[model samples]
Target: MARIKPQALLQQSKKKKGPARISVSTIILFSLIVVLAVFFLHSTYRYWSQRSRIQIEDKESVFKGDDSFLDSKKSDLPGYAVLETAKGSITVELFKDSSPEVVDQFLDLCQRGHFNGMLFRHVIKHYVIQAGDSDKLGAAEDWTSKGKNYNRLYTSLKHEAFMLGTSKTKHDNGAFEIFITTAPIPDLNEKLTVFGKIVKGEDIVQEIEEVDTDEHYRPKSSIAIRRVTLKQSI
Candidate 1:
């Protein structure tokens, strides 16, 4: 049975087809280099932690003291609204000292306007812009129903911004909401209940903290507050 030789059976069929064609071209070039290195590290982690989309300017922020904060909230405790927003207007003063059932249900719903147009959905830039829990308040082309009612699922207070000294920290929600902040969120000292600031507009709260959010950050457009006056005594 010894006879093999047609050029040694074509050199043993080129040594078994040269390592199975170099092991199938080295597994297709190592699976295309591991899918291009996981798409370049997921596009550089979404270009530096994504979170941009701004253009909320019409600006506003005026305050001239009579001890502002809606005049220290109707002279040390009462009710007030004056919401007015598109990118301007803010006045929220209330204090049953720290929050008597969220300032008496937010002064019985801004005395009634319940927050005029309603739509501060939530901004979060320097950190904070939220408006009353949308019952539809402003940016009014025609959308009414600021019923402003609440039992406040939760919140004894502590959501304030700015340290104890004020850089900016107005709040409301005793009935719905009214958030406002810029710099100075000293861990919402004494636990959120700033009552007021933004005497005038605050460059419309940094142009609604340079808005442009969606993936649950909520705030694409619609920051209406159009009306909520009540400079009452303060």
Candidate 2:
């Protein structure tokens, strides 16, 4: 090949095409996707952050004020329950002052041995474990399913982990069906009467929550409530 001059080579290279310019439509589409992704991520973060924050607040409300809160409500002994199950025993500090009706009903049932031999009919892992429906045991009638005129009680209590509350059935009945929150459930706040919280046997709750369950969330292995013993605070 003949020797090419430096100036000629430079001009020839300059004439060659550069990479094609991106279309405005493509740039717009990319920017829109980036914006949408950021928005979705931000929304997800906010949702989980709110959940976590509520859980933290609930813990403070439930566990931190165990003594002072009870003392303020009743100078006398506070009411509590010892739930003996096949798994283990779970001690619950009842909120008698705040949720008197529900707590009284629960105490009555416990004294009558109504909860004994009742199976935990529902279990949603990391959510809740429920029981107290006599109908599930083939009873004539579930007294819990009676009296649909349940006036919703709103309180500062929340569905914190190990917190005990009444389950709202499809029948919209009385506060007989009880449940324990395996995890913080902010959505359940003000919707149900929170009567108690687990003061001990947190591990037992975790164990029961992890049990194998059917499609209806019923425990396959049968976790029964052996007995419920009431206790008076000293």
Candidate 3:
């Protein structure tokens, strides 16, 4: 049997250790690359997600009727209407310049007594007080298919909010249904046709909002709208 030299044995040992060291370094390098790649992908996804969310929010903000626009002289005239409820009367100033079509349709309904004796069909605290559900509030069955009824009014007005710009918010023309927000909801600015805002009797609106409601948000006790009369500014 040939005996291996000490120097040769040391060389063989070095060769074996060299491959192990290279394998360890290669594995460490590969692991570092994988970690970096995962981190980059996660960061990129987050950036895009945040950018998309910001874009959607920015688009929504545009339709909130820019504060500068509201301050401008081009804003609507101070025409108002009284919504006489069983609780009290709420005066809402119509936005003729901002939402002319909505105001016109509402006034037309008022002239035709479409909202006379309508119930405050739905109420949600810190949300909205909905009315003009003529279908549910005992409107004449014949009026269902008749001229300028609630259903007809819904289809008449183009969702004016979207006319301002594209939006992700759900578009609701709200042609016949009049809803008063209990709070300043910017999201609703372009989603719903905001024909008017309550100028007076906000307390009455608050009272209506506080009314006891059922699971479906309908007032347990009937809150009737006695009449809706449009008052022009002299």
Pick by TM-score: which candidate is best?
A: 2
Give, for candidate 2, the lowest lDDT window spanning 10 residues: 138-147
lDDT of 1 by residue, 1-234 (tens): 899979999988888774434577788899899988988888877764552311112122333443467656645544545567776665555454554555555566767777677776756555556666543322221111111231224333353332112212233543455656554433454334455545555676777778896754467777777777765545
lDDT by residue for model 3 (188-224), tens: 5444556666668888888888989876667899988
Task: Judge candidate 1 at residue 139 and give its lDDT.
Answer: 28
lDDT of each: 0.54, 0.74, 0.64
Q: Candidate 3, residue 18: CA error in Å?
A: 99
TM-score of candidate 2 to 2 decimals: 0.55
Q: Is candidate 1 or candidate 3 better by lDDT?
A: 3
lDDT of 2 by residue, 1-234 (tens): 999999999999988969889999999999999999999999999999999999999998887699777677664544878999988999999987788877777877787888888888877776677886643522212322221332334323463578988754433454267778776654565445678889999999999989998766678888888998888861
How far in Å is the alpha carbon of 43 misplaced in model 1?
A: 99
Per-candidate TM-score against the hidden true structure: 0.24, 0.55, 0.50
Q: How many clashes does each candidate structure show, in the order listed?
A: 23, 0, 0
At residue 15, give the lDDT of candidate 2.
88
Query: Quick one: ranking by TM-score, best first?
Result: 2, 3, 1
